[model samples]
Every structure is written in structure tokens, then in C-alpha cells.
Target: MIQKLSNGFKEIMIETIDKLKSSDKRIALAKIAKTYGDGGQTAVAETFHVSRDTIRKGSYELESGFPITDAFQARGRKKVEKGHLPHLLEDIQAIVDGQSQTDPSFNTTQLYTRMTIQEVRDQLVLQKGYQDADLPTNQTLNTKLHQLGYHLKKVQKTKPVKKIEETDAIFENLHATHEAYQGESNAVRLSFDTKDRVKIGPFSRGGKSRVRVEAADHDFGQTFLSLFGILDMSNEHVELTFTASKVTADLIADQIEAYVHKLRSQQEVDTLIINADNGPENNSRRTQFMKRMIEFAATYDIKVILAYYPPYHSKYNPIERVWAVLEQHWNGALLNTQEMVLGFAESMTWKKKHPSVTLEENTYETGKKVEKNVMDQYEKMIDRAKGIGKWFVEIHPHQCKAALYMGLKTQ
Candidate 1:
């Protein structure tokens, strides 16, 4: 019977003969014999630049008829000392199971630190015969742990805020408005909001380095400020006005006026639709002021439409999104002083990646306090009316007109 050579087996036999002719045939034979078991043939051939058949032939010559035993003995690299494979495996299992009881997520470092070599040795002495056990070193344990798919990491739990009931309505309104603006040739809808009572300057410091250096020297003081901004949906222009007080309807009006004038300067039409939340300022006891604002807008043939998002749904506001971006930019990091805070705040500019409207800090004098009567009137109107228009029309009897006037002159 003729033995038909498998693919590349003849080439391997020729290569094995070449190795046998080398100065150290025994060493070469041992290497070739090692390759026969498992998937070692390809690896041995690549390592020694020989063929698989050459390795197979040399392996056959070395073992003769005791193929199974010879191949098993030649498998992998020889262990210089083989004292306790079973004991080491047990120790590792014990450590893993013990840690799993306390913290199922315990990583390799935690395991290693918690289970010392002496402790493991003691446990082996008690559970099994230590004389026959070969304890693994920390490095070996770490490698083994990794091989077992154990790794160190920080597990974090995320708690996202639940969507309020009003969010859907607000989002719906925003989408409708956005679609309407897209269809209109020249009409623009601007979303405006304020970051109220944001402390300016170095109100807080963060980071490990900052914490160490400014541990005792840091001065924590509050510098109240407001960021009033308008986002023009048409051209994506953002106009910001910074103030040093609580945001009120008057301030909102002032910003709107400035925005309108700027638009007019750019030859843009004055037909603007302003959207805001139903805050006290928006529905203050300023009927005359609101009326004037409306009449003034009418004079310019500009229709002022006020859109209010539902209660507890402020997050639905586009301006709220802007604030979120700003907050992310300034999150947890501290500014050393008011100047630093202002610089940092002013330094914030929008880009295509995180597209935002730019806000410039304009230091306006505060001390402007809204009267209790105005608030009371606003409360009454809000209480009597339902939905968005209730406050503007019912809260303060004549306040909407007054706000209009204030908005017009300011514009």
C-alpha cells in the first residue's frame, strides 16, 4: 500500500530531511516532535522555517511507536517544576468565589489585594496539603485572572430624569413652529430663555490640582448674574444680554427690542414671534407695558405672538437646550474669580459640532425689584385663566398692554 501525501506533506518531509542534516538534529527533532500534538505543526514550521511534513517525520522518528505518550510529553513548553496544578486551581477558584459573595463585581486588583500570598498559603495548608501545592505569585494570579475575564473598572449607575407630562405638548409645539418657519419664506420665530442667578467669577474651584492648591485660600462668594438670549430660528443668529438681577418681563422686553432693532438694521422684517415660558415676569402686573409692546409691534406691522410651554416642561424649551450645552461646558469646573467666570462665560461660542448661540456679558445695574402688587395681579390672572394666554390676559388686567408699551419703547 502506498501512502498518498496529503497537501504539502511531501514538502514537509523534504524540509524535515534538511533539518536532520543540520549540526544539531536531536534538538531539531525534539522541536519537530513538539509540533505534532495540538495545532503546533504550523507554529513550529513558521518558527523554524521548516515544512509541516518535515516536522511530522522528525516527530515520528523521535517517538517511534509510542506516539501518544511522546506527543503528550512534548506538548507546550516544559514546566521546570510541577508541584501543584490542582492546588493552584483550587486557590484561584476559592478567591474568586469568596470575592463573588461580598462583591460580585470585584476586579483583579481588589482580589489580589484582599487575598495575600500568606493568606492563600494558610488557606491551602488548612484545606489541602501545602507541601504538595505550588502557590501562584501575584503576577501569575493577575495574568490568570485576566485570562478568566476578570478586569478592574468603575461601575456607574445612571439616573436620567423622567419625562414630565407636559413635555410632549411642548415638543409638539416646537416641531410645528419649526415646520411652519421652514415653510415661510421670510418669517422668523425666535426662542428666548435666561440662565438666571448664575454666580459670576470664581464661585467654585474643581479638579484634584485646584483642590490641593486652593484648599485654604479659596474664597467662595456669590456674584449673581443673568444671561438673556434670543435664538433666531431663521438665520441661526443668537443675541445675548447679560444682567445682574433676577430675569423679569422688563428685561425680556429690553432684549427683544434690541434684537428687533438689530434685525431692522440688517434689513430684516420686524414680524417676530417670541416664545417663552409662563414665568412671573412674563405675566407681571404690567398690563400697560404689555399693551404698549403689542401696539408698538403692530406699528411696525410686526405680529408679536407669545407661545408658552406647559408647566414643569421648561426642559422642552430650545433655550433650555442652550443652557444644557453651556452647563456641560462649565460643569463641575471652577472659575477663580468673577473676571475668570465672566471670561469663561463670554468665551463660550457656538460651533457646528455643538452649535450654540453666543452670549456676551453686558454688566447691567441691578436693584430693580418687581412690586408685590404686580405679583399678586399676575397670580390672579394666572389663577383665573387656563393655559398659556391666561396669565397675559387675566393675571394683570392692564399689564399686557403695559408690557407691550415697555417692549415697544425698549425696542
Candidate 2:
């Protein structure tokens, strides 16, 4: 076969011979001997640029195959740290499980020590008395660590709020108010809250879009857009207002005022049930928010009922689900300017109705509050439910409206 081989075949074998090892090299020579039949070894050695004696040995071995026990025991590169580098695996585990044994945070099962592969290699050499040559490459170490169930992961927040004793009672009150509003034709239940603050400049948002856009390298405290939103549960209507100011009590009150006017213009809504979280701006105990709410009730001739969810339960709000939809809709687009942000928000549809977009360029000052003495006089109109007063409050139009209007008139 070697004598019959073309020059091209001989050249290809010469190029590949250096890459073959052990049994592979012998197998190539044995195949040539089988093809040649006689003087095959000499013909193969001369044609393929190999020693004649080496080819003869391979031919004899091919003719008389050895037993399984006579074959080589091991092949390939040896293990990196053969002699159990003395507590190396245990130390790696210790570093990977940092502070988790004593202090744990949120809903993550895996603890991260934030140690790199190079750091691990250095630690082994410096502390464990292991030579540099014995340590495997970083890639190999990473694979080994993964095999041992250690991985690099970010921390997640899953810890719930401290269990409230009156959680059931609060939920019941919320349900009763919802049902009451649902049954009344003159009532409007609006889920009132602010969405996550978005930075004005180019920033990365979650999700994929058809068009590719790049975000800023860092999210500095540049300009930001605050969304004060209200979702009417009765008609599934959404009202979103954009502001460049902090989400304060004044801002919340202003948003409520606009929402009230819009609803009254469309139909008769004598009662406004506002569902929201117990955030600082809209807290039941916030005197400023209470004062503004009473005036809001008086101006619109509508009774206001504030129903707050338990702490850390903001996800239960109906508007929260709408906000989630809006987030998903614009996640892929680049919101580099306020116009883009507003455009994306207006384009997103929830329940087949696009939200009414209003730009509130009104520069609202933070920390604006009514005097304690004046607020105390109007507090009489605010009625709180017994035992769970902080979670429920009712502001009657007849009670505080006169006092609030009088005060405003004097101002």
C-alpha cells in the first residue's frame, strides 16, 4: 500500500504524524502494514518518513494482539494536586460560604465570598504550603469548584416584612372597602402610587427590543423622572403624570386633585377610594397628606377613603400590575430623554386602554407641610378604624371641608 501511495497521501501523513501519540501512532503504522502484506514495514517506513524497526514492531503487535491486562494503565495529563494538598477543598468551601453561617440575607441559598480563581491559587500557595506548579489553571479550578457545588451568584432580596398581627383584619377591611366601591355607581376606586424612579439620561432597562440601543456606562445622579400614577379599578383606566420633583405629600395630593377633576368631568363620582402602600408620603399618620386630602375632599365635594396595605405588600396593589406591564413594554428601548420615556409610557396599553399622559412641570417644593396647630383642628374630620387605625382612614366632605375651606379662604 505504501508503494502504491501517491505523493499527496505521503505528504498528508508527514504533516499529521507529529500530532499522533502512543496507540494512535502505532495504529497508523499497523494499517499500512496490513495494506502492504509483505515488506510492508520497510515500504511504510521509507514512504512515511518513519524508522523501519518501529514499523516492524507495530506490525508484530498488530498481528499478535495483547491481552487487556498488558495494556497501559493510565493515559493523558496527570491530576494537578495528586497528594491531597491538605484541606484545600475545605478551605475553598469555607471561603465560598462567607458570613452565611452566622449572618444570612434574603432568599438566596448560595453564599458568595467573592473570591476569584487567582485569589484561590494565591491562597493555596501562601497559606496551605502548596507549590505554584501543583495548582491547576483558573479555568480548571473553576470547573472543579462548580463540581463541588460552589458557584458565583448575586444576592437576592426575598425576606418579607415582619408579620403583622392585624394583617388579616387589614386585608378584610381592604376587601370590604373594595366591594363597597364596586357596588356603588357614584364611587370610584383608584389605586394611587408612584412607580420606580427612572433616570433621565441613557440607562439600561430590562428586556429585549427589536432595535439595538446602548446605555450610559454609569448611572450618576443626573435628572430623574417620577411617575405619579392612578389606576381606576372600576373602568380599568390609568392616569399617569410625570414630575421632576420628589414624590412628596404635595405631589401625591396634586395627582389626586387632577384625577378627581378628570373623573368628575366624565361622570358623577361622589366617593373616591384611594388604595396605596403605607409609604412615607402617603402614610395615614402624615399630617400634611391628611390636611391636603381634606381640602381635596372639600373642593371636589367628594368623600375620600384611604385604604393602605401592610408593609412590604405593595405588590398587591392593582396599579402595581399595570406598572409591571409598562416596565415590560419599554424595557428594550433606550429612554435617553424625557420625550422617549413619555412616548413609551403613552404607547403601552393596559386592559385595552392607553393611560392618559400628563406632564406636570410644576416645580413642587419638598417638605411642604401645614402647621401642627392648624392640622390638629382639622384632624377631627379624619376618622380611623379601631385597632387598625393606621391602615384605614375616612375623610368626610362635610366634616373637615368647612374648616379647610375657611383656612384656605383666609390664606
lDDT tens string, model 2, 1-411? 554559888688767875776556766786776787878777777766788766766666676784123245466655544445546677666655652322265354544545677877787677667788867678988876776566665566767667689888999999998876677989988898888788777777767877768887786857889998989888899998888878889888978887778677888989989899998888988878887888888778889999999876888989999889998998887788899999999999999989999888888777766776676687777899999999999988988766765654311
Worst 10 residues of 2 by lDDT: 99-108
Query: How many residue pairs of model 2 clash at the backbone?
Result: 0
Q: What value does the lDDT take at residue 213 in candidate 2?
A: 80
> How much is the lDDT of residue 97 in candidate 2?
61
Candidate 2, clashing residue pairs?
none
Q: Give lDDT tens digits, candidate 1, residues 1-411.
A: 002456477567646656555324534645644645566667556545667776666666566743322355667753322443644664556655564322344442333234544554566667766552455555665566555444443444555556655556555655665666674655667788777556554444343332333333555556665677777766666565656556656567767776777678767563465666666656333453353444446456565555566666677667777666566666455654545445655556554332323343444333344356554433332223233243223222243344444543332
Among the numbered candidates, top TM-score falls to 2
Q: RMSD to native for every prediction? A: 13.1, 10.1
Residue 102 in model 2: lDDT: 20
